[model samples]
Target: MIAARSLFRAGAAGVMALCVALAVPAVAGAQPYPSKAIQIVTSVGPGSNFDQLGRVFAERLRQKLGVPVVLENATGGQGLVATRRVLNAKSDGYTLLLTSSGLATMPAIVKNAGYKAEDFVAVAPLGQVPFILYASSSVPATDIASFMSYLKSNAANLNMGLLTTSHITTMLARKFGKVVGGELVEIGYRSSPETLSALLANDIQMVATTHAIAGQHVALGKIKAIGVVADERTQAVPDLPTFKEMGYPTLVINVWEALFAKADVPKDVLDKIRAVSREIVSDPSYLTAMVPTGMEPWRIPFDSLQSVIDEEAKAFKKDADELKISFD
Candidate 1:
C-alpha cells in the first residue's frame, strides 16, 4: 500500500510539473508587451529625412514605452532591403519599420519589388514631404514650362537625378519626359544626400528632390526650383509655384512615410503604437521641430491607414499602367 501511495505521489508531481511548464508561457505572454528593447529600422541612409525622423520618433517612443528604442539604417535597393528585414522579423511587437509610402506603392512601377502592400500593416501615418523639381543654376529655365522646353531641346545633354529609380521621383521625371516629347537621362542615387551632392556638383542637371534638400540650395542660389510637386505652396518656400499652378496639374506629387509592422502583430500592441503616434504627432513641440525640415503631419487613425494605402496604390497603378512603367 505504501509503494502504491509513493507511485501516486510521483505521478501527481509529474502532472503538476507539466502543468506549471505549460502555464509559464501563457503567464509570460500575459505580461505587457515590449518587455525588451525595440528596433525601428529606416529604409534610408543616415542623415536622410526618414533617418532623422526615425531617430527623433524613437527617442519619444522610448520615453513612452519605458524601453530602449533603437534605430537601424537599412539602406539600398530603394528600401527593398529594409522592407525584407521587417517582413522576416517575428510578428512580436519588438521590431518595426519606418519607411515611405513608396515601399507600398513602388511595386506598381517596378515589376520585381519583392513585396506587396498587403504583407505589412501601417501602425502610424507620420508625415508628407513635398517633392520639388530642381535644376542647376546653370540651366536657363526658371519655371516648369521653360524647363520642359529646355529639356526638350537639351534632352541629350541633361540627365535627371533621383533618390531611387523606383519612386515618385522617377515617376515625375518620366512624366516630364513624356510631356516634353523626349526622354531625359534618368540616374538613380541611393539616397537624397547623394542625389543632392550630385545635383550641386552638376553631375546631373536636373533632380526630383525634397524641400529639406533643395530648399537651402534655392535660398543660396546654388539651384533653381523648376516647380514644387505639391497641391499648395509650402511654408518653407511660399513663393515657389506648385506644378498645378505651373499648368501641369498632373505632375503634383508628395512623398510620405509611415510606421509599419507585420500584419499579424497583436491588435493591442498595434493600438498602443497608434495611440503613442497620435500623441507624438499632435504635440506642438514635435510639430515645431519638424517644421524646419519641411515635413507636415498626415494624421490618420490606425484603422484607416490600410484604406489610405489601398487608395494610394490604386492611383499609382493607374498612372503606372498609363505610362507603361515596368521594370521588366
Candidate 2:
C-alpha cells in the first residue's frame, strides 16, 4: 500500500512538471506578434485612387508580413470617419489609417471632426499629387492667360465644380477668381467623378482636380489642362505649366496621403511598421502602381514624420485662417 501511494504521488508530480514546461513559453515569450490579420482603414470610397493606394499597400503587406491585410473603407466626413475608427482601435500595429492630404486640412475645415493633426502619427508618406485645372474643350480658353481673360469677362456668370466649399480645391477655385478679376461661382459635388461628369456634360465650365482622374480625359481631348497647382511641373505632364509660371505663384495645391497610427503605439511596433513602410514605398511594384497615376514616392522616415506633420498642420491652419474659411 505504501509503495502504491508513493508511486501515485510521483506520477502526479511528473504530470504537473510537464504541464508547466508546456505553458512557460506561451506566458513568457509569446508568439511573434501580428501572428494574425491586419487591417488598413481608408477615407475614400471604393474605385477611387485613394482606395487603389490602400489595396496596393495591403497587397504588399500580405507578401511582406506573411498575413492577410484587409482594407476597410469608412468614407464620410471627408476623413473623420476613418480617422476616428483607427484612433479608437487598439494601439497594436494591427490597425492603420491610410488617408489623403485632406488629413492635413480636414480638421480645420470640417466642424466637429473631434480630432487634431497631432492625434495621429504619420508612419508612411506617399508622394504629392498636383491638382490640374481642367477646362472643357468647348470652352474658348486655350491657355492660362486666355482662361483668366474668360473668367474676367464672365465674372460671376462662370460656374466651377468643387467637392465642397471648404475643400482646398474650392479654395483654389476661389483664389483663381481673386487672382483674375471674376467671381467664378462655386458649385459643390459629392465625389470627384461627379465633378468630372459635370465638366464633361458642360454642366460646369471648369474643375480643379487631380491628374489621375483628369489624365484620361485630357488624352481623349475632351478637356484641356491649363494650370498645375504644384511647385514644379510633374513628370506625368511635363508640358503642363505650374501655377507660378501662369502668374499665380502661391496657387500651389498638391495633395498627398500617408499611413498613420495612434500616437501611443509602442516604439518597437512602430519601428517594425516603419521598416515595412520603407520597403513598401521603395518596392518596384509600388512605383509601378504610382506611375499610372502621376504619383511619385514621398517616403518620410519614422523619426522625422512628426515634425513634418506639425509643419504641414501649421501651414494649413495659416492658410485656412487667411481665407476666413470654416466648414461649419
lDDT of each: 0.81, 0.80
- How would you encode candidate 2's per-residue C-alpha lDDT over 258-314 as one tens digit per residue? 888888888888888888878888888888887754566665665786687778777
lDDT of 1 by residue, 29-68 (tens): 7768778999988887787676677677788888888999
- Model 1 clash pairs are none
Mark the regions of model 2 whose C-alpha exceeds 4 Å error after superposition: 1-29, 299-304
Of candidate 1, the 10-residue stretch with the lowest lDDT total is: 162-171
Model 2 TM-score? 0.85
- The lDDT of model 1 is 0.81
